[model samples]
Target: MEQAFAQNLMQAAQAVEQQVDDELNRLEKLTESDIEKMRNQRLETMKQEHKKRQEWLANEKLTESDIEKMRNQRLETMKQEHKKRQEWLANGHGEYEDLPSEKELFDITKKSERIVCHFYRESTMRCKIVDKHLEALARKHIEAKFVKLSVDRAPFITERLNIKTLPTIALLIDNIVKDKIIGFTDLGNHDDFSTDVLEWRLGVGGVIDYKGDLSSPPDNNERKKKITVFGKKPKTIRNGMGGDDDDDDNDAED
Candidate 1:
């Protein structure tokens, strides 16, 4: 399934590139007057679209037939959204991928415009928790690439990117690191933080393109409570894991 998705995106990208090349070749042959005419045509098209939108929303003066037509348009819009989502899935945007090789990370960053990489250690409990939320986010936000890299396997990248902490979510755009979220500090200091908390954090970093409100906290009432007896008391946690020195050392060894 993933192979098929990737192939579809490659085909689409190639088609777009061909179109761009053709347009550039045509532009080279066109005069300045031709460019101005094309610009005027684009402006007129935008004006028509804007007028249609106004009519779609103007309920006061709309006749029954107009309302019925608008309702059908709304249904068509919903279908279009579904089709767009399918296209997104086909473009390899709907799953949290655990990259097989560290080299593949570089490939993903180059091909994908926006990427969220969770640099995690296998033994760390917090990293596992982060994986759960990230998996959910990958399905929800189909606008960015979500992936994970094992700190042990990706030694060169881990050192170069300065990913010293467990569960470090590195946000990258155009292969350049834009932001990093180390530990659960930004997320309320707890093991059971909701998916939206992580989603909101990613949204803040511009990794995910979303329009939903991120201001409100997830209504996890037990955020202040400890999940297990071994877990630390609910308090502010810094870079280090909330567990003992042995646990921190274990994560560092990765």
Candidate 2:
């Protein structure tokens, strides 16, 4: 009876030990699964953090203050250029620098302190008479500038100024059209005309301050007066002839 009891006790002990080993194996598998899950969660969190950092870097750029500063710089540069242009104009560059082209004419008439423009046609005979007077007046009146604008060359300026006559004189003061003199209609119909008559007429129009005698006789060039040099050789006109052929010129004059 004792031997049978001892064998049965041994078998019971072995079965208990097997049960303990099986329980241990089950706990080990559960612990390993929990560790793997925790590792995957940590890796996903790291990926999200990396993505957020990259987004923050990408959004970095010029701030509002930087953009505003750039705008201010541009405005300052424009102001400086404007000041320089005004200074250039103030230095009397507009007084002497005549308009070189049709494009410059408008700017000159609008910007110059005082401007006198003679609009004339090339083939017109009256244009020469106007040019002669303008040349002499320009030399005498240094306060005003004289400019010649060809009517044929500048059709746009002619139309813009509303010039109808072949020889038109337009005066501008402070870049504004003050007055205009058209044709020789003011000089009267007499064939013999004087520059004093022209000058005085312009004076009447407030163009010049010349108080010279208006009724005085005109010069020889203006009146084309015949100077009777009795029995004398005529002086040679050095106009590209380069020859002092007094005999031929005297005979021609006779």
Candidate 3:
């Protein structure tokens, strides 16, 4: 039994040695063509990998170019809008003007694309209130030209427009009367109306471009009414302080 076990171990050792000798002989017999084929296969694989990398890089560059194009277009549009606003400021559009004569009013209306002309009387208090709001609006809305024509100075234009009211805001486009605000009636009929209300009213006339939402209430939420005396403040009024009675009083006061 010991002799048989020793014989089996010797056979296994011989088998392993023969397998190694066979692998070494096979490697020694390799032809130049076989080695060249292996090199070519590796080179082909590297070329394929390089082509894929180049394609990915090209796609990335195209995406970056598209983004840059959009960015430049947006910048150009913003620059054009700014230039237009500056031109408007240079052409007497930013502030309110007081036209002295009917000819001046006509000339301004003809030159300006849009105009908000307030016909006022010096003696009228309500007209003074409108002046305060319009003066502020003129500075803010530079797109439209704001001007005031005193009924005393521009008598011919006043009669032609049939403006009987003390403070009538005429919205004109290319010298044609598009609309009119016949006093505080269109402006919530109150003395203490906010600038936002007046702005909304003018926006309705399409003379000025108002930024606020027309569907919503005025932006100034506080102080709907001005306190006349140190006594108790009046109740919050929505549509106007007084009814027809207040309007009659306003007419007499005007």
Best by TM-score: 3
Better of 1 and 2 by lDDT: 1
Question: Between 1 and 2, whose TM-score is larger?
Answer: 1
The C-alpha lDDT values of all candidates are: 0.74, 0.60, 0.73
Write down the TM-score for model 1.
Answer: 0.54
Clashes of each: 0, 0, 0
List runs of model 2 lying over 4 Å from the truth: 1-100, 190-192, 212-254
Q: Candidate 2, 160: how far from true, in Å?
A: 2.2
Instruction: Please write out the lDDT profile of model 2 over residues 79-179, one tens digit for every residue.
Output: 99788656545644333233456677666555556666777766887777777777776666555567787766777766556567657676665555555
Question: lDDT tens digits, residues 85-186, model 1?
Answer: 776677688899998768988877666778889988889988999999899988888878899999878887776665667888887766767666778866
Q: Model 1: which ten-residue window has the lowest total lDDT?
A: 237-246
Ranking by TM-score: 3, 1, 2
